[model samples]
Target: MRHLHIRTPRRRVIGALAAGLLCTTGLAAPALAAPTAEPAAPTLADGLALTPPMGFNNWNSTHCRAEFNESMVEGIADLFVDKGLKDAGYQYVNLDDCWALPARDADGKLVPDPVRFPHGIKAVADYVHAKGLKLGIYTSAGTKTCNSAGFPGALGHEYSDAQQFADWGVDYLKYDNCNNQGVDAKLRYTTMRDALKATGRPIVYSICEWGENKPWEWASDVGHLWRTTGDISDSWGSMLSILKQNLPLSAHAGPGHWNDPDMLEVGNGGMTDTEYRTHFSMWSVMAAPLLIGSDLRKASDATFDVLGNKEVIAVDQDPLGKQGTVLSSEGGRWVVAKEMKDGSRAVALFNETGSPQHIATTARAAGLPEAGAYTLRDLWQHRSYNTAGTIAATVPAHGTVLVRVSAGGRWATRPPAVELGLDGSPLVQAGRTAALTSKVTDLGRTPATHLSVTLAGPAGWTVKAISPTTAGLLPTGRSLRTKWQVTAPGSTATGSYDLTLRARYRSLTGTRVESVLPLKATVVVAPPAGVSSLGDLPWLSTTNGWGPVERNTSNGESAAGDGRPITLGGVEFAKGLGVHAESAVEYYTGAACETVTADVGVDDEKGARGTVAFEIWADGTKVASTGVLTNAMPAQPVTADVSGAQVVRLVVTDGGDGIDSDHADWADAKLMC
Candidate 1:
């Protein structure tokens, strides 16, 4: 079911998951405080969505196709009850896009498409209710919906539309942001919230702004569930992308307000069955709204299995409603833990890498009570594990191990930590062998001995490598460096290849426990074409964030973004903007060609926030700039007039909102005549 799909805003291509998150934009300009009660609250939130909403959304699976009719809705409603999805808590039968008529009726009221919904929306809602289910509708805050759906948005029609939906027995509303014309996000959203409140409807208001303007900061009082990231597609990469975007905002999610990572992509075939389970597990742990976006009429068995994991669903529906968070990340493994209402914890060992990995952590390390043994239950396999102080798991490539730990038992002794990292640049050009040194450090008191390093190249590609063989004793707090000669094949593809690096060592303590640090080397193959990519831009660096220099060939993260696209220049570039949001890129206007041009815009995916200016610097002086960009504007084609500058310094800065949603992007950024 497809309609006129606009470019999905070319959202960020998520790279590594960052270990930390930026709580606030430390822009030099003070952020304006959230609106106060003197202006009166905009909407009557009234504690809706006490838990993340469990339902079905039509956008991801069937987007405004001719099949998007009342029967389709009724068919899904029947599946909800027949297939036990309703039993597991999925209730809403939603109409996402294309259900609205081309225009409002004579009284400016939204009318259902006559051909598609010959019986009208009220009749459909009544049918859903008859099946013991709820109904949800989709609209936009802008002038029009995000699809070719002919109905006008609820911008000026919010109150009347809200009343109309209420009268039609609608129980949910997904308000989107398209054709919004860059109006102040807070004001516009608040307007619709008040309009819904005026109708005295108990609708679950879902804000679909796609994380622009930092909705988490101000939407707690506005909507029940607000999208904290871009849309989700039925692919592992897209799911992980949305997951990483919403995970760090865990603190803002709760009983009444949850971080919406958009609709679910499970049951879709873009990902494998295992990957689908991982997708559902992570979303459940994050306490995100579980809106199934698949056609139920022809659901697959694997889809049913992933969606019907009642034990996992219990974690999501726990009355405590506390969203899980990443407790510890080592190598490519993450130990995510969530507290349950019954003093229990749901822990997920997630392996984000493409290789099988062994990840172990103590209860204390994962934020559990330092001194208690926990009864662990395997949620997926439906088995129980022996009470233990430590959880050591071997996760498959891009897989997960989710378990529930019951509190109150024995105490655990903290384990030693060994860190393995590369000493030189992680990026290597094709055909060149680089001296890759692995720095192994003992962060704990346990002495390490008999250390060895192993390296593996990409599969199917022959890589010439001379790795370090053996090492002697390394006392606690001591560090050792081993060198490896790694050469990529001359004909290697121009992309990022993970070089598997494993450090094996034994604890020289009385117990003599062995440990292995699974790390990967990210080598960026320069395009055989010769022009440097945006990430490889000579002087591209940011003025913010901590640097593990989260760099790849495409996107990177400086400390500020916390694994988010490098936020800088008053915009978050899903491309690699380095360090902080106020950084600059240095390049020759004639580096690889004649002129350096890029389509620049705020990183708000669509309508970027705040005012941003792009400045071109010459020898210690400013030359050209696209003044301060107004709020909610589209990306402008900016060609810098670097008249006589040799090494041009491109600078971008936040115009006040303290770099709020100022993720600037330079799409198709290149140097050309």
Candidate 2:
């Protein structure tokens, strides 16, 4: 049960137990180790600097394309140092995967892809270091890298690989969980951790195992930072998904170890500038690593502003180093807070929903300054306002208002982008037959308000006694009281049906402040009378890696290509919000299991190859994987299976990458029980 331990300048030793861990092994003694000397066995402090990591990765910018190259790296490093990013606490010019060729030398050493990085890794590292930026590289714990450009894996050569990185002058290593499988997930990382330490090069160990085995628990003792979510894309869906994933694990970050929500997609044009600001603000509040993924050499003004928000950067680089978490969320609004040094705090009001609304909550609601009135400062707009008691502001649609708070007094202020929320919760879910009652109040003293309620039920369901469906109503006074007799559908799913309520209030000046409430009511729909089975079949698929697999490939292949690992799509399950149902997949890439299937279709030809395999607990466990060995010319569908299996996966080893799968087009895939 390892937990994150924060070392505040005040209570030098806040946790006696952590103090014991520190004392028991002199963990904090090597902070100023000689950089040029033999690497002090790598530690969390070694992986991440006293400051959060700041660097440019190729993922968001190049997306595993030909765009990631030596010139790109050289240009970004120059801008990083020139723009004072390094001086302002940015370091680490990291080159993600795909830089290495698929072939290994006789010594089992990974070779740089001569076509992409013709000058070799040493030259690349020299280039970055010459720019006063540290050089970081990527690898995997398994036999292959996620990109499938078979870099020398740390699997059987952890020690040798670590030494090789040290020899290459690689200052950071993002050791990912590629081919490693089974219950030994941590061991796989631990093996590399120890190996990197043995090199004594002071290489910052970046654990990229994708949040498996709760790396936040002890990874701080091993690596500098750990990715708490699966890899993130530069799209809104991917960014939102990753941010939502980082919300719950907030408490696990502190000091030396930080939760990595993947790289920055700011300035990448995948999302709007406002959305990127929200992304940066939210990540800062989460105390996440600020690795830039966009091409900095040609960043937009908005990107520069977002990446250079001094106030927001302060929160991310706060000495508190404490990660923030979600306090509450409703409709399209979410409130999150981070405890800061000097007992001050930072709160973020996020609007992810459509339509503009006021998102309001108090200090206590933010999990800080409990029971006391505090002054608030808007970090974004740099404004200050003294609320009579509790603080409130009106947020805009798909926007955010960040408030910084201290014990007392006001600070320099600017125009605030105010947002507000309901102080009291509306009637969430009363039994369908039970009467519904709710009280909505305004924190901004807005005048008479209007409220609307919308309810959706089982298929072909209806509510006979309801107010206007597509309309609005004014409130009686400072609050609104409402009630309705709700009836349940006879064939209801016997689960919870979401009920949404939107309240609109007008300020004294007649400005509208809208707030939404979302709750769930359970109907008495009965479940099946007997036990159920999901069946034995392909349960998961990932491209170019492991898990339920589908054919995957990089379009970089000329006639000079051979083979690559099949990376598959990763999945996680949680509650569904009507669009994509969240299903928690227990499988992370590194595990082996039985039974498999893939939902695949081909588009173009080229050398298309895919495989599916599973594992049983014992040796007799049957396993199978299949693929088209040559240029299929056209796309085709395929499947494979085995008997006596526990987990399964499908994969495509070559042909193409990204949305346009050169080898094939993937629709959807799943594994059976």
Name the top TM-score candidate. Answer: 1
What global local distance difference test value does model 2 have?
Answer: 0.54
Q: What TM-score would each prediction reach against the true structure?
A: 0.60, 0.57
Per-residue lDDT for 57-99 in model 2, tens only? 7766674678788888888888887777777677888887778
Please give the distance, in angstroms, between residue 598's alpha carbon in candidate 1 and its true position after superposition.
Answer: 21
- In terms of lDDT, model 1 sits at 0.63
Q: Which consecutive 10 residues in model 2 have the weakest lDDT in total?
A: 22-31
> Best lDDT goes to which candidate?
1
lDDT tens digits by residue: candidate 1, 1-673: 0112432322322222211111100111112233222321232349778888998977676665787798899999999999999999987888886787878878899988899999999999999999999999988887777664335778787788889999999999988877676677788888888888888878898888777677877888888878876566554544554565566677677788888887777876667677788888999998988889788787888899999999999989888978887776544477788888987788898875444455566666656675434556779877553344566565655678888876553212322345555553344556777666766665443456777666667765444435545567766556677667777777765445656656676644433433333334444422223334455454422332112223321123222224445333344444443322343554433322435566665544323344556665553355556766744666577665544443455555544323333445554455442
RMSD of 2: 16.4
At residue 306, give the lDDT of candidate 2: 84
Instruction: Name model 2 segments beyond 4 Å from true.
Output: 1-47, 181-183, 367-373, 411-673
Cα distance off (Å), candidate 1, residue 461: 22
Cα miss at 324, model 2 (Å)? Answer: 0.6
